[model samples]
Target: MFPIRDHNPSGRTPYITYTLMAVNILIFLSYVGLFSDERALSRFFFDYAAIPARIVTGDGALTLVSSMFLHGGWLHLGGNMLFLYIFGDNVEDEMGHGRFLGFYLASGIAAGMIHILSAPDSIVPVVGASGAIAGVMGAYLLLFPKARIDILLILIIIFRVFPIPAWIMLALWFGMQFIGGVGSDPNAGGVAYWAHAGGFIAGILLTIPLWLRLGGPGFWRRTDGHPPHPEARYSTSRIPKVRR
Candidate 1:
């Protein structure tokens, strides 16, 4: 199951979120040509992506931020952008533009550091905005736990959309990350589960102050863990068949 959209809508335009998506897309496009050449791609990732071993040796420190914008492939970019598109607006709406950008970057940096600590000797390059996007998911969970999210569930040939609380989806996602992190080798160079998990925790922690300022548990009581705006309702359109 993957989230297709959320019921909650932000009151204002989410300029920062849109800008972020555009920047990521543009950066990914710049490297699209390198994918066909294995050696060239490897060199590109090595130079820009975050490699734990290189960080451990006190080098490539800037990659912690750079790698967040670098994705492994089109699917990588699409998935991350989708999540950011679905959930990022509300978070940015709550935190305002400048603060949200800072929160995103800080969470990403925290994620990279955690990943480096998890596999300090691993030479494989880690790249993607997943870690940072995981942070946005974390914030969304805390701020709008009861918000309805529409998920597209595919089973064989059956395709259906189901609406569920945000907490359930995010909780399941977080649980899977932990399980995957434990089951896989940190040196294997696959999904950076730890980074995702770390960014999630960091986002929650960073958002705590804002949550408390809004009245902590009282905030939940006021909004009932949903966005402080009218919820959007969706309807399915039916196609009419022509009589032959």
Candidate 2:
């Protein structure tokens, strides 16, 4: 299922979130062409993307930070940024711009380190903002458990949009990542499920202080688990009649 949007809107402009999304998209566009040239692309990733083995060997220290902004493909970049766009604004608003940016980077670096520890000998490059985005999702879950999110479900030829609570969707996503991480070999390259999982948990733990500052359970009572703003209204389209 895909998330079209959320009912919860940030109280502020969320400039940081917008800037982050634009930056990631711009960087991806700059290097997407390299993907066509295997040699050039490999070199590009080697230079900027996270290499777990290199990190374990104490060589690619900068990649832990740079890799959060790099992505391998359009879908890879799109999906990660989409998640960031959806959930990042609120966290940014809550943490303020500066702290939010620092939190994002820290979560991403931690994610890369977790991957390196999980597979120290693997030579594959892990690239994407997913780990950082997962951190945003983690924080969102703690702060807005009852917020309604619109998820688009595709069942073969059928397509439908369903509104579910934030906790359910985020929890399910975390569970999937855990299962995927356990089922696959970290040394074998595919999805960095462990990074996603670790980032998520880190986000939650990191947000604990902010949550407590916001009055902890009292905050939930005040907001009723939704954003502290009015929900947006969207009209449904009528199905068109087809001639037989």
Candidate 3:
């Protein structure tokens, strides 16, 4: 499923989130052409992406930060950006631009550490902002649990857009990452489930102070677990019809 939009609107502009998305896309496109040269791509990943073993030995420390800007492929970049785009703005609005940027980086670095712990010996270079974006999802789940998100579901040829509570979507995502991390071997490269899970948990914890400052459970009551503003309404009739 893919989330197309959220009902809640941010109180302020999410400049930091937008900047992050731009930087990640720019960095990925900078070296995407090397995909045809397997060796070059591998070398590039090793140098710029997060390698668990290299991290454990105090080497390639820069990758903990650099890797957050790199991605595996077009789909990888797209998916991560989509998630970040969906949930990041609200958190960024709540935290303010400067703090949000710092929070994003901190969450990503923490995620990298968790991934390294999961596979200290694996040489597979970790890429993508999923772990960091997972952090945003975690915070969003806590900050606006009752907000509605429109998710596009695809089953064979049957397609539908369903609106569901933010908590449900974010919780399900976290559960998947947790289960995947436990069931899969980190030494084998694919999804860095542990990193996603760790980042998500970290995001929640890191946002606790802000949550408290906003009055904790009282904040929930004030906004009813949604952004404190009017939701934007779009007309479905505006959609264009396609025919063969």
Candidate 4:
């Protein structure tokens, strides 16, 4: 299950978040056609995607930032964008445009470094905004633990959308990454679990000062772990049961 949206919305317009989404989308579109040719696609990723082994050799240092804007496929791009859209706004609103952008890029770089540490010899190319978006998720969890998030659950023909506390969802997601990181070999990666986990941890660490500036635990006591603004309410949707 994944979040469809959140009940808490930011008070200000998240221009930086929207701009980030646009840039990621446009960059993915610009290179998506290369998928038609395996060699061409591989070459493209080699030039732009973060490779742990390349990083160890003191090369492709820039790909850590460039790779945040690249995606493996439509679904990969869509999922990361969805997450950023949901959690990014409030974090951006809290950080403001300039600081949030800096935080995001820093998270991505930290994530890449963690991945390199996990598999310095691996040649696999990592791409996607997930590492950066994971940072936003990290920040969101710290700032709004009690916020309501609607999760879309799919079980074959059964489809459902249900609201749950953000803490439950975010904690569960972080746990999954930890489990995956422990169980999978980083060199033979399908998912960069370490990067996700590292980025999430980094996001939280980076946001701590801001949280303290807003009053730390006292802030939570004041807002009850919700956004310091009115929470949005959404209507639930259900799929009609098919009669046999």
Candidate 5:
């Protein structure tokens, strides 16, 4: 199952989220050609992506930020962007643009640090915005736990769309990350599950002050754990009748 959209709409424009998506897309496009050349791609990833060994050696420190905009393939980019698109706007709305941007960067950096700590001797280069986007998902869970998310479920030929609480979706996602992180080796270099899990926890901790400022548990009671505005309604258009 994948989230298609959320029922809650931000009261203001989320310019930062839009800009982040565009930047990630543009950066991915810049390196799309290198996919056909394995050596060149490896070189590029080694140079820009977060390498745990290099980080442990006190080198390539800038990669923590650079790596957030890089992706291994089209699917990697698409999946991360989809999650960001679905969850980012509301978090950005809650935190305001400047603070939200800072939160995103900090969470990503924390994620990279956690990954480096997890496998300091691994030479594999980790690249993707998933860690940062995971942070967004975490914040969304805390801020809008009751918000309805429309998820598209597909099982072979069976397909369906269902609306469920944001907390349920995010909780399941976090649980999967934790399970994957525990099951896989960090040095294997496939999915950075630890980074995702780390970023998620960081996001919740980072958003706690904001949540408190909004009145903590009382905030939930006030907004019912959703956006403090009217929910958006979606409907399908009926087919037009054909004239004889």
Candidate 6:
């Protein structure tokens, strides 16, 4: 299942979210050609991506931040940007642009650290905004658990778009990451599952203060566990129904 959008809308413009998307896209374009040349790409990743082994050696500290802006490929960039696009706006609306930017960076940094800890000796270089976006997902769960998310699911040749509660999707995503982290070795270097999980936990903890400031359970009671605004509506998909 892939999330296409959310029913909740932010009251204010999400400049930070838009800007982040642009920056990530631009950065990926700058280096995407390197993918055609494996050695060059490897060098680029080592220099700019978060290398767990380098991090533990007290070097490449700056890469923890830089790496969040990088991605392994087109799909990597697109997937991360899409999630950020879907969930980030409302979070930014709640946190304000400046604070939201800080929260994003902090979560990403924490995620990189957790990845480093997961495989301190691994020389593989990891790059993506997933960890940070995972943070946004985490906060979205805490802030708007009942919000509706429209996800596109494809089975064989079947295609369908369905809406589900935000909590279900986010919780499932988190659980998959946690389980993946337990099953895989970061040294093998595919998905940074630990980073995703760590960033998610960090995001929730980081948002707790804001949650409390907004009135904690009182806020939930007031908003009824959804975005603190009217829900947006979309026309139903044109896919024909299956004949029974």
Q: lDDT for model 1, on a 0 to 1 scale?
A: 0.94
**lDDT tens per residue, model 2, 10-47:** 99999989999999999989988897899999999999
How much is 189 displaced in model 3, in angstroms? 0.3
Q: Per-prediction TM-score, please?
A: 0.96, 0.96, 0.95, 0.98, 0.95, 0.97
lDDT of each: 0.94, 0.89, 0.89, 0.93, 0.91, 0.92
lDDT of 4 by residue, 136-165 (tens): 999999999998899999998779999999
Query: Of models 3 and 5, which has the larger lDDT?
Result: 5
How many steric overlaps does candidate 3 have?
0
> lDDT per residue, candidate 1, 30-119, as tens digits?
999999999999999999999999999999999999999999999999999999999999999999999999999999999999999899
Give lDDT for model 3.
0.89
Question: Which candidate, 1 or 3, would have the higher lDDT against the true structure?
Answer: 1
Measured by TM-score, the strongest candidate is 4
TM-score of 3: 0.95
Candidate 3: regions farther than 4 A off? 236-244
**Model 3: how far is 137 from its true place, Å?**
0.8
- Comparing 3 and 4 by lDDT, which wins? 4
Which pairs clash in the backbone of model 4?
none
In candidate 6, the residue pairs with backbone N, CA or C atoms under 3 Å apart (3 or more residues apart, or in different chains) clash, namely: none
TM-score-better candidate, 1 vs 6: 6
Candidate 3: tens digits of C-alpha lDDT, residues 1-244: 7788898778777889889999998988899899999999999998999999888898899999999999988999999998998899899989989999898998999899999989999999999898888888888988899998988888886677778899988888889899999999999999999999999998999999999999999999999999776887854422245678
Candidate 1, poorest ten consecutive residues by summed lDDT: 235-244
Worst 10 residues of 4 by lDDT: 228-237
